[model samples]
Target: MRLSQAFQPTLKEIPAEAQIASHRLMLRAGLVRQTASGIYTWLPAGLRVLRRIATIVREEQDAVGGQEVLMPTLQSADLWKRSGRYDAYGPEMLRIQDRQKRELLYGPTNEEMVTDLFGSTVKSYRELPKTLYHIQWKFRDEIRPRFGVMRGREFYMKDGYSFDASYEEAGYSYFRMMLSYLRIFHRLGVKAVPMAADTGPIGGDLSHEFLVLAPTGESEVFYHHDWDLMDWGTSPLDPQKSEDLDALKEIVSKTYSATDEKHDEASWQNVPEDKRRSGRGIEVGHIFYFGTKYTEAMGVSVSGADGTAFHPHMGSYGIGVSRLVGAIIEASHDDHGIIWPDNVAPYRAAILNLRPGDESCDALCERFYQCDPEGLLYDDRSERAGVKFNDADLMGHPWQIIIGPRGAKNGMVELKRRATGERLELSVDEALAKVGLN
Candidate 1:
């Protein structure tokens, strides 16, 4: 993508309402624009990052036997009413009336709707243990939505539902999802600790919220240092194995991690003083095992082995797809701007033409850009070197390929790593190779 033709309208001055690093940087970097209170229009660059995050989330969900399905953003209020939560959900839910005067709502969450959908279809124990998921936009009427996409009223999310015939089976599904969420965050290049959390309106005895540590986070968190050393990617645990799931669950139970709302002083005292870690963290994902809460309330049941109708245990898992964009920025950015991880960056690298109109410089940049045009952002704009350099840093591509006239004339270029301000002078081919463009 050429900067000259790109629709990224980066701001030099910070927006007055942006209170956090992610919010201020998102606006300054031209990732999104506020269209209404708590609502945003994701610009091209922002959309790319959103899509990449969703893709990683989808892949992880699929690995856990979750079948992809698209649910409606607007749902009939009858489902909520049947689940006995219509009146209980409160003002955060945007209740509405259609032209026919029928009640409807922009779904804040899909527990009731998904329960109804599952009940209307699968009807036996043989089809038990099915998980369905979708990546879609969700709306919640936040009284005061702020902090950019981090707490936006309307945001993209990946929510999944699991249905099982027994409590034990549901437990397996819950553990499997915990594993999946760990891998998801790991691949997205963030360390999100899974902490025991209250179910709240979702209504579940068992729940865990994945929180990414950041100085600007809203909630204070306490955790064990072991969380930092563990790597989910190399774990031998398989989702289909019951023993493996139990082992995973055991590790989680033994770990002392919680938000301020659920912190236990007695349990905190059990941890070794040196191993205890505390910081502020932003929530990016949540998982819950509500058992028969929705199924019993909505009269959803599947046939048992004895041919008797019984409510299937259920669980819901959620990842804030859009909020992750901001949460990631909060956790990863430096003074310059967003330091997008390799897997989720909008572009892998930015190819800067330090002298755009200069024939040698333009040719070298063009060569680098052509190697992977789709994955590289080319700064071909007729702007000063300072302007290009600043924008490249502000956008925060993983790498920067600098093509200045002096080096371009000698068929050489500079490769700079965005995370660390390390630059290397190399041959044109070597520069491309370093950025994985070759």
Candidate 2:
């Protein structure tokens, strides 16, 4: 994309309200703009990253046999009332009234609604197990919505629901999701630790929260230093048939980790002193098995093989899609700007026309463009060399290819790695090859 024609409103100074690194960098780079308190309009660049993450999440879910569906954002209060959570839900549940004076709610989560949907569709034990998921916008009215999109009142989220006939079978689905989520985060170049967590309002005894250690995280977490040593993603997931629950528990049991709520001094003492690393972590994903909680409450029952009415065992998984943008930055950014992973970076490389109007520089940049380069943000703006350099660094693309008259004379262009500030002078063809534009 050409910078001259792009709608990036880059700011020289940080916004007064942006008090953290993620918020500051997001504003300075023109990735997003505040539409209101805690609500944002994702500018082109920001939308690109958001979509990339959403795609990865969807791919992982599909790989594990999850079917996708869309649910209404506005739901009737009747469902919540049936689940006995209409009054239990706090102010965050954005309550509203239609012109008919019917109580409606912007769903904070889709448990009750999904239960109502699933109950109407399936009625036999043959379709005992099914997994449904959706990527949609969710609204939770935060009293103090700050820290940019990190704690936004309105945000996009990917939520998945699982239904089964038995508690043991649904627990397997939880394990499958845990394994799938590990790969999802690894593909995005972020390491997440699956720590046992308390199921807040989601109502489940068994839950795990995927935590990404970030300096600016809200909750302090304690864990063993070898959290990354386990290969959870490579583990087998055979949810259709029976699996060893004890073996899976053993893997998670090896790690001593918990959010502050579950941190126990006795358990922490059991680990070697050197392996203890207590720090703050951002909650990226949560998976839980809440069997018969909403299904029975909403009367979502199906006939079993024994010809008896049975409530389908159920589970729910969630990832804060919009909040992850800030969490990623928190885990992987430097002083210049956000160091985006290649998988999520808007553009893999930035081709800077150092001498924009110069004949040789413009000609070479035009050739690069003519070649239909992949993932290149061509900066062909008529600006000073220093200004271009600073902006390129601020954007923090992985590779920077600078074309100038001085280098064009020598048939060479400067290639620099954004993360390490390492540079190599290469011929036009070599520069193209280095960035895979060739």
Candidate 3:
């Protein structure tokens, strides 16, 4: 993506409405623009990052045996009514009526709808366990939506539903999702701690919320220091094994982590002072083992071995696909701008042609840019070197290939790491190797 032709309208002055770092930076970096009170239009650069995050989410969900499915944003009101939540869901649900005067709603969540779908389809115990997921936009009428996408009314989300024949089977599915969430966050280059959480309207005894630590987080959190040292991605626990799932559950059970709403005073006292860690955190993912809450309410059941109808235990897992964009920025950004993790960055590196028209500089940058045109953002704009440098840092590419005339002429270029502010002078070939350009 070349800067000259890119539709990234970066702002020099901060928008007055943006109160958080992610919100402010998102607007200034030209990632998104507010179209309504709580709605946003994602720009080219932002969409690339969003798609990348969705890809990671989709891959992780697939790893856990989740089948991809697309559920509509709008749902019939009858589903919620049958589940006894149409009235209980409150004003957050945007209830509406079509020209035929039939009731409908922009679904805040898909528990009732998904339950109905499951009930209408698979009816035998042979198909007892199934997980279906989709990445889609959701709308909840937040009375006071703020903090950019963090608390937006309409945002992209990855929601999955799991159905099992029994409570024991459901427990396995729950723990499997817990392990998957941890791995997903780890791959995205963020440490999100799973803490005990209230099920609220979801109505489940077992629930966990994944919160990413950040100074500007909405909730205060407390956790054991072990969370920081543990590497979930490298863990040997396999979701396919029941014993491994149980072990993963045991690990979570022993860990002391909670939001302020659920913090136990006695439990806090039990932990050694040195092992206690407290900070603000942003909620990014949540998992709920609701058992038969939805199945029972919506009359979803599968035939047992003896041909008896029984409600399937169910669980719902959610990751704020759009909110993660902001949560990651909140957790990883420096004073300058967003520091996108390499896996989720829109472009892996930025090729800043310090002297675009210069014969040597243009030739060197073009060579590097051509090596991986799709993964590199070529700054071919006729702008000053200072502008190029600032924008490169603001965009937060993992690497910046700086090609000044002097260095280009010598067959050398300066390579800068965005996260660490480290610079190295390397030969053109070495620079390509360093950034994995080829």
Tens-place lDDT digits, model 3, residues 1-438:
888989999998889999999999999999999999999999999999999999999999999899999999999999888999999999999999999999999988899888888899999999969999999999999999999999999999999999998899999999999999999999999999999988889899999999999998888999999999999989999999999999998888888999998999999999899999999999999999988888888878889999999999999999999999999999888888889999999999999998878999999888998898888899999999899888887888999999999888899999999999999999988998999875
> By lDDT, is 2 or 3 better?
3
Every model's TM-score: 0.99, 0.96, 0.99
Runs in model 2 deviating more than 4 A are 230-248, 371-374
**Candidate 2: lDDT over CA atoms?**
0.87
Task: Give the Cα lDDT of each candidate.
Answer: 0.93, 0.87, 0.92
lDDT value, residue 364 of candidate 2: 87
Tens-digit lDDT track for model 1 on 1-438? Answer: 998999999988878999999999999999999999999999999999999999999999998899999999999999999998899999999999999999999989899888988999999999988999998899999999999999999999999999998899999999999999999999999999999888889998999999999998888999999999999889899988999999999999998999998999999999999999999999999999999999998998998999999999999999999999999999988888889999999999998888878999988888888888888899999888899889998998999989899999999999899999899999977876778776
lDDT of 1 at 318: 97
Instruction: State residue 107's C-alpha deviation in candidate 1, in Å.
Output: 0.6
**TM-score of structure candidate 1:** 0.99
**How many clashes does the backbone of model 2 have?**
0
Give per-residue CA lDDT, model 2, range 1-438, as digits (tens). Answer: 889988888888978999899999999999999999899999988888899999999999997789999998999999999999999999999999999999999989999988999999999979978999999999999999999999998999999999998987787788878777888898888888888889998898999898899888888899998886765556564433345444566667888989998888999999999999988899889998988999989988999989999999999999988888888988888887878888898888888998877888888888877666446789989888888888888887888989889998778899999878899999999988988777
Regions of model 1 farther than 4 Å from truth: none
